[model samples]
Target: MNTAHKYMESTQMPSIVAKSLPKTWMTWAVFFFFCASVFGLAMRYFFIGDFPVLEYKNLLHAHSHIALLGWGYLLVTGILVFTFIQNPIRLNIYRKIFLLTVIANLGMMVTFPVQGYGLFSIAFSTFHLLLSYAFTYHFFKDLKNIKSNTGKTLIMLSLVWMVVSTIGLWAIAPIGSILGRLHPLYYLSVQWFLHFQLNGWFVYALLGLLLSFMEKKGYSVQISTPILIALHLSLFLTFALSVAWSNPSNYLLATNAIGVILQAFAYWIILKSAIKYLNHQTNLSKNWINHLLWIGLISLLAKAAIQAALIIPDVANIAFTIRNYVIGFIHLVMLGAITFGLGALALNQNWLVKNLISKIGWITLAFAFVSSEIILLTQGTLLWAKMGFIPQYHLLIFLASALFPLGLIFLLIAQWQASFQKHQLPKFIHKQKNQFKSKNTETMKSTVLMSLGAAMLLMVSCGGGSSENQGSYTPPSAQKEKVADPKGIGEIKNVDLGDGIDEALAQKGKAILDMKCTACYQYDGKRVVGPGFEGVTNRRRAEWIMNMITNVDVMLDEDPVAQKLFEECLTRMPNQNISLDESRQILEYFRKNDFERTGGSDAAMN
Candidate 1:
């Protein structure tokens, strides 16, 4: 049988049903990437920036939206569009329901950036998700009448997870809100949402889609599918167990250990499976598919390695650095694996293979992936050592950063070129002659308007005024004198507070100042959380500053400066229990600033 006949036989969907899926799926992918880009940029800024500017709380919000709404929801919608088309239900109601879901999802996407967690955003997003769930349920109910094993397995897994993840979402919003009030644990809730959306729904559905696609293509490996499924299932179960078990005691830790081992096993299985399939494939059209599969497999391995390293006692000091590796791994999966896979599917829909622009775009993107992974790994490692090397690594970092945007531009250009080569009107538009043509046009126009509105809201929210109030600065004390010729005008100079002061003592003082004074005082007396410290030495003695930093809790309770500042700022300066050496470093930093203002050399400050 020919490809069309084979597709019809494999899927229960009618011929027309098969035809509609590609357009819907491609549209969903486009929307997903657009949202994902915003999410990726927001996270990069949040993680790499200074504290309190883009606080952890705000970052968590962005992370949750991007991973769950942007990546998971959008990808699932795209894949479902394809799956439903292939399974061609003859029911017009099912078709309209799916179409309405797409429309609702688009509406939610528009509201999300503007309203954020506000009523409209919440309502629209909730509506869209519910619609998706409804559509999935209806689709699967229809599928139960079909008899294909591959189709049954794929649809069943995808639908079950869709329901599961949806339920998890209900748990997420309230839990996140409550924990957000408490903080720190708020981050844990965000993590839970991410894991549920990405691992539970998105990854599972994507795997099913891949398996379905492979089966449709008539390429079957004897051991590859089962091995791949086992690995995927193992990874999912490990993640679920790890997330479900909250404790980190001996028993919980042991369970986590077992989970990590299972993940490792999963990685090995996937890698081996990928190799087997790669060797078996004879079709050149499968090249992109193989590339995406391998990238995903390698990322899983890389993630497992990072996890294992974190668990090892010998190199546990490097655990902080593992976060960067994790981020890199996520990027590889999202951009290299998922994005590439979707792109290939889109290309196949157009039957435009081996375009120059697409090839260049992929190459540039791959370059970006490798360079970014290297830079992130290096920076994370250096950071773990408590050493600064920003200047040294700036070149590679910037180069890696350029890759994604550049590749995106090239891809967009290629897409535009491809569009010009084809007719502007869709096949349905040409065929439908008189049936609701004007209505369809209006619907399309509404979609455009809604999309534009949503885009505007996102721009405003992202670039709008800071969420926190930016009020007038109030000096901590009436005696807070501003020096006209404050120190540290040109460059910073290190100063020795005293000879007997040990490194540990300096660290203690620095820690104290970081905790207590950071919100209100900069070493150079520049205004930040508080007034800058250009002439702090002239205004207050070393002992006075030390006392203030180390005893701010008491000062807030009694001292006039503390009380006045607290009343003015409406925020208390927390005390940092400082040692002698920490107090000395702060004093030394102040002295250094003073010396720099006086045009004194580093030797003079020392």
Candidate 2:
């Protein structure tokens, strides 16, 4: 009996705990939340007409908060809990706190539509804030004994900032109401809050956590930690100064500019260090890591370019490109760099690594689809703003969209195969494989099948139809005029305008519109949480339009027209700081479109 018991006890332990098991739940949550957010975003863009049960605007706001808070924040927190908290007592506390927070958040999420930002929303939001504070307290308390290291220091800083950011959440409602009164400092304060939370807390904290994981996996490289610290200090200081000083004085601007430059340098150094490390580590077979590293570097470059462009007077003329830089850059950083890294880490977990091919395929598909969507959306906006020509990338878009589901299918299959075929593999592989093999095949099968179904549903809803079917705007063959590039890169030439309007002007208009308008406006004049531009020309004169577009907030505060627009839209349009010439092109596009609609010549419209 003793010998038999000893034999039963003799089992090999896994090299790494199967952290990926928890990640599965988190991934599903993220996937659903993102889908919800995307749908809401599209609805905001495409559906402008009134609805009784819930306004599109409110629905979208709820979606945004839920997606960010519920999915993104919750997933990160869950991962942190799963990884760092090992004690049963600590784990139970975490689970209970998390469950309560989720429930309160879910209550808010569900109530928002019915309440429509009323007392219920206010109450729920307040409760949510309290829950957040509790969460922060508990999480920090748990992490207090963690040994000091660069990664941990970064994470600690991030958490502190997160606490600070949450404080802003409490002020949002009151501050928003005050802003309507044209308080001189209101916009500045709000901007400051946004910058701190987004740039200071969220980004910083996420990166720190990611870095910590990378270090644990023996994937990190030696870099100048002091330089990074200096850069972070500069970032915080500049952000604070920029916010605290309501007026955009020379000193403030210069300091902010320097801070931005330092940040760029920091990013470059980090990228170089990471690349060197990755190059040396030949054992890491994952190809996705390379993609993630490149994306991070590119995002850093994008940030620098955006900062530089903000100083350029004629940037508005190239607004389409600039708009892409701002809006698209966020996704590139968040989805491309951060989420990509997370996915890689999740896959590396013992459970997921066993089913490597499916895991890799699913992740690759997700990355490809998301990246393609961002690129296409940005490019489409730019083309409309600059050249007024939309290229035929529909097939590429469709294929990219399909890849996600296909990958998910493969993942499901791999998971299933892992479950049934575990006993057939070699001892080491079998041990690893058995870690993920479902105790009950039926339950696992149902979950996998459901996930597959969800993926399919997404594909269907997005429309599997080819881009050609939707119609493509091809430029007319015309005479081209060449001019020397103002920046001295090369000669520039005039290109044809597409079928939609005066193609050349339309193209130019598209670029300007993309830079200036895409973030806030869709092609159709529906609001993107802001006013649409369907008949903008008919309503405002050229100078008025230019001024309003360039300096919208100021106009909103003082100008009756802007104020009226704001009241109707219930959201203020932010200034793109566009120049006069670019504004003219946008105006011209509106006029051109008007003429085309009314069967009038361009000369007549002018």
Candidate 3:
């Protein structure tokens, strides 16, 4: 089919159906994306300089919440309604649910930055979760009325994963409150939610939506049964990769490796299946929509390759330890793949304007994502290698991030123009349509080049600063003072131990030690990654032990005792960021353990 006929076949809706297609919802989804990008830019700015008024962690919470729910979830639901729900009543119900979701999202936007995960923010989040449940129910009910098998099973499974992912979120509060945020279970809960949402729900939904669109354009989607099973099974198994970060057993790592292999297999088979359909669409080869889809596929492949590399324990450890790697991977999936895929699907369906304006916007956005991801991964690798800073890395990242909002602004304007110019065109433009269109395209091409060139120059100029000039450097005196204490050259000044152990505190401390400390230290009189803790209570002062727990970074940096231990062990103890109270709790636990060995004589007290 020719391009125009293909578009007609894909997007030719009856007048009433077209009007009912929830264009406003799509616009809102794009607006949310723009807002999320602005928030992201604000976050990047903080790395250049401090803004104490806006807490960085709180902004992060808001950014992730809005970007995921406000933009990602909303866009998926809007497209699903457009594709599947033909009945007017069902469509109206979806509209209402969509509006409620928006309200919940707005509430989160207002509350999260102010109070983090306090009562109001949690309430808003809970409300959004309930709204999702409602959406899932209605979506399944409507799915039964549709007879098209193309992408149907995938869509259903995607929704099921969406609901299942919430189980992780619900587990977070209890784990965090009872065992503290540093607990492995708490981190595991958060990772569970993230893994399922990103790898399961979003991945499946986008793939299914793309297949559905293909079928609408008269292409048969012939996904084999094995490929489909592999896809679903891979999603469930790959969640082990998320659990691998907590330094689980070798068995779990092996399981994760298997999952990664299965995922790669599934992706390859699916890609192979889709190629036959894609190869026949010659007219689409040069289209921007096709280009975006290709970018998404390439990103997916890159993500899979990265996952494959993580099967190596050293690489997995580095990935877990480095914040940059984690952030880069998330963006790789969210921005580089899912967002681009969504944009292509939207453009294909004519939900987005197919014109020069959108083309420039998308190209700019693509450039920004690519540039920023490269910077992130490069810096992460440098850090992993202990090669230090990247020379004005934050500034470079900020400059690249600035382009995200700019591109979204162009897209927003394009959408506005589409809405405004619907069913209306000037007579002169109609008479000279080709000429006008070609001239605009040429102008836009020049504009895109200039914009990209300027961005590149800014990044290059900023990145030329010395790495020593950035936040990575710390002065000796300031570093010492950060963890210095008059009592023992560490943070803890005093520890008043009772004759007996604090049973409750000891229990909590034992939990913390199991999760955070035992990875390196052993309770038996045998050496491990760090020294054994069997007789530590008798060997070290209570204040000293507490200080080491709370101030390992500065202790290793400045204290002779810590340096001697480090030299003996030939390993630097990692700073677990244990709090003072937690350190005291750990001291109590040590006393209890030592008492068991010393026959309850409290020999350390002497």
- Name the better of 2 and 3 by TM-score: 3
lDDT of each: 0.51, 0.53, 0.72
Query: CA shift at 432, candidate 2, in angstroms?
Result: 24
In the range 1-606, model 2's lDDT, one tens digit per residue, is 998865444422221123223534454444435444443444433433434444556676576566556655665566566656665556556555654555555555655544344444455567756776787788789888876665666666766776776655556546655444244344555555556655665556555655676687777645567776865766665563334233334455566656766766665665565555556763445565445444544554565556555343244223323444444544555555445554455455533333567556656655664666566556655454455423544344444545545554555555545434423556765565455344323544564555445434433443422222222221111012233121111111222223445566555766667545555565554455576666655555545665665555556555555555555455545544456566556756776765655444233123
Ranking by TM-score: 3, 2, 1
Task: For residue 154, give model 1's deviation from the true position in Å.
Answer: 6.1
Q: What does the lDDT read for residue 385 in candidate 1?
A: 51
Supply the TM-score for candidate 1. Answer: 0.64
Model 1 stretches astray by more than 4 angstroms: 1-21, 38-68, 87-116, 145-155, 166-168, 172-180, 183-185, 219-251, 283-289, 308-322, 341-354, 385-387, 390-399, 416-442, 451-606
Candidate 3, position 454, lDDT: 46
Query: Best by TM-score, which number?
Result: 3
Deviation in Å, model 3, residue 576 alpha carbon:
8.6
The weakest ten consecutive residues by lDDT in model 1 span 484-493
Q: Quote the lDDT for 256 in model 1.
A: 45
TM-score of 3: 0.69
Full-model lDDT, candidate 3? 0.72
